[model samples]
Target chain A: MAIDWGFALRIAGFGLLLVFSILALLIVITRVVTRFASKKGPEEKEKKEERE
Target chain B: MIDYQTGFTGLTYGHIILICVGLIFIYLAITKKWEPYELLPIGVGLILANMPYTGLLLTPEQAGGVPGVAGLLGIFLEFGLYKYTVLPLLIFLGLGAMTDFGPLLASPKGFVLGAAAQMGIFVAFFGALALGFWGIADFGIKEAACIGIIGGADGPTTIFLTAKLAPELMGITAVAAYSYMAMVAIIQPPIVRALISEKERKIYMKPQLRAVSQREKIIFPIAVMLIVILLVPRAAPLVGMFMFGNLLRESGVVDRLSDTAQGALINTITIVLMLCIGASMSAELVMRPETLMVLGLGLVAFAAGTAGGVLLGKLVSRLSKEPFNPILGAAGVSAVPMAARVAQHIGQKANPRNFLLMHAMGPNVAGVIGSAVIAGVFLGILG
Candidate 1:
């Protein structure tokens, strides 16, 4: 009829995946933003100077 | 002759009430100028679907085709389109063509918010399961997954997956998903504010400085498709169709196909889909306590997704040196520009100078792909 134990384990496994993936997701997002923000720093200064 | 009196009963009253609701949607679409492109059609569709004894909405009259019974739309749904799984797939092609992955490519980090928002999907799954365990919702595994995706809040994606995977629940899922997307401009604002301090909401995100090259644009969807395919092949029908549509736009070789997909194809599918979905709402099927539960769960799912994105967003703000407005996080639910607009509106309330609409779109679009990937993952394991 039903594979109760298997189904429970799979749900449990997915829950863990969501948690670990979210942590990994935050790490990746932080790195990318910092990379882009740093890359554009000089250009931002140049624009500010031009405007002033 | 038609037995008009006998054919309609309890459903007649319920449908009349829903028609009034549709009228309100029509008012919102027209006078309020709210999401007119889709709301008007969906409103009329809701009315058409709810009307009882309207043969046009039934399943072809069981081959009797008696003069006064079960008009053409019903028969078509039973045999022609959904049963054959044609329209939903084609609709994905058009959606792909219309979508520009530029925002997503410009800020790959937005995928995290997209992923973050999907926490709503899984959370809603558990919520739906809880509802079932409570005997509040009559959902099993597949139906719960389909319903939970209302958190992803993209219409075609919701329709595509729900149609193929769980047709019976389509009416509730579509109504809840689209309605919530429309109301995101309303529901998400408060949640976003509470989660993010005004200072975080007021923070400005610098625009992506690099110009995305056309060559890269063309290559983008292909790369995404490859990764998604490796992860979840079952989602290929939707993902492949979406990427193919985007490819048509980016390829520069298929202007005609791209134009048709963006314009003619979307219009036709929109009409067919709305009507087909509406037709499924026969009174007995839709008025149950379970249907109400599905609707309630969908709202909770969308709100949870929005909150989850903002929470992660606040975390990102702290972790980064530059100020990142956590309001943009709520846009991670993928109502496209609508979710982003809410972010823009709320961000401006806190700081008039902040312009986060485009920034918000990065995660908004990413949420779309995230949900598709999640759908694929589920399909990979279950179906």
Candidate 2:
């Protein structure tokens, strides 16, 4: 059977693009969630320090 | 007339060569301490499979005849690898249980670097196409796709994709992927150093990583599963099991299940999986010019991945305010702690005060996700 060069290349292009986009979305979600977590961390730290 | 049948009766020089190859793998695993858990079993399986007329593993001819007539190892291969795709996916579950995504959660940019390292996969894909198109090798798109994943440096992902796309090439591709993964320390440093200068390697950032909240840790796997699976439903089986394993570990309520998944379950699956992978490497299947080409392409893919990660690290470092050691980018090849450790070793050598392990780990783990996503894409397209 003959190889489909066009299909292979298309998969390569589309695959890389999808991987980056999905990972980019992940990075965004992680940053947003961590932002809230970091905000809460400071307040908790302050309360602990005041109690001490 | 007395008829004599012995293993030696059908043995050929090719079988002997494969036996020697198996011994070499065993030697490397034991003395060299190279992925001993996998290579050791695989080496033994290779020896067992290559012994002529042993009936330990049925030839394809025998397998095609009667279902009950197949050997024990043949049954394992048929059911475990081809039938259910159980072993590789189970290995992924164990990997998920063992992995800690805290570093990745702390530094999300590592995800980008992780994605960048997959450049090797695409590059090798095109390279394989060119080879096949030019009659250099007889690789169809499916076979090419299988060969390309060796660049991911993720063993289970490689096996999973190869099994789905090109079952014939599974043994050689698995060997190539794991071999490079085992030799990350040796293969990666030169490429990393060549890509990034001494100044970049010496660049040290603060070691303190913000603590990831338990809630965030718990949510991370779920969130990842939803996002990745939604984007590439083909990746659901591997990603779902991986996330399930992580949830068990992070849930704080299932320590027993988590422990079993990470320890006993993983160890048992690794032995069986590696043996099956090795046993599949019979001389008739493995002793071909195409196998050598696949091995060569695998090395190229690995080198390209390391280079891609390091190069992107340089780009990200220049853009970010914090001091970023580009050496950590080499960890994005997804060989787990080995790639990260190599980054740390190289960084420390450049500057004793520069510790890049945790930083490298962010991208290192991200590479795992990245490879899985890429594999999913290939399966979606080809499978």
Q: Compute DockQ for each candidate against the true complex.
A: 0.10, 0.62
Summing lDDT over every window of 10 consecutive residues in candidate 1 chain B, give the lowest-scoring window.
B3-12
Instruction: List the candidate 1 regions with Cα displacement exceeding 4 Å.
Output: A1-52, B1-11, B64-70, B79-81, B207-209
Task: List pairs with backbone clashes in candidate 1.
Answer: B55-B70, B55-B71, B56-B71, B58-B74, B60-B75
TM-score of chain B of each: 0.91, 0.97
lDDT of 1: 0.74
Model 2 Cα lDDT, one tens digit per residue, B1-383: 88878888888888999999999999999999999998999999999999987787874445787656788778778778876788999999999999999989988889989999988887777777778888888887888888889999999999999988899899999999999999999899889878899888889888888888888888889999998999999999889989999999999999999999999999999998999999999999998899999998999899999999999999999998988888878899999989999999999999999777888899999999999999999888779
Predicted model 2 interface RMSD: 1.7
Q: Model 2: chain B TM-score vs. truth?
A: 0.97
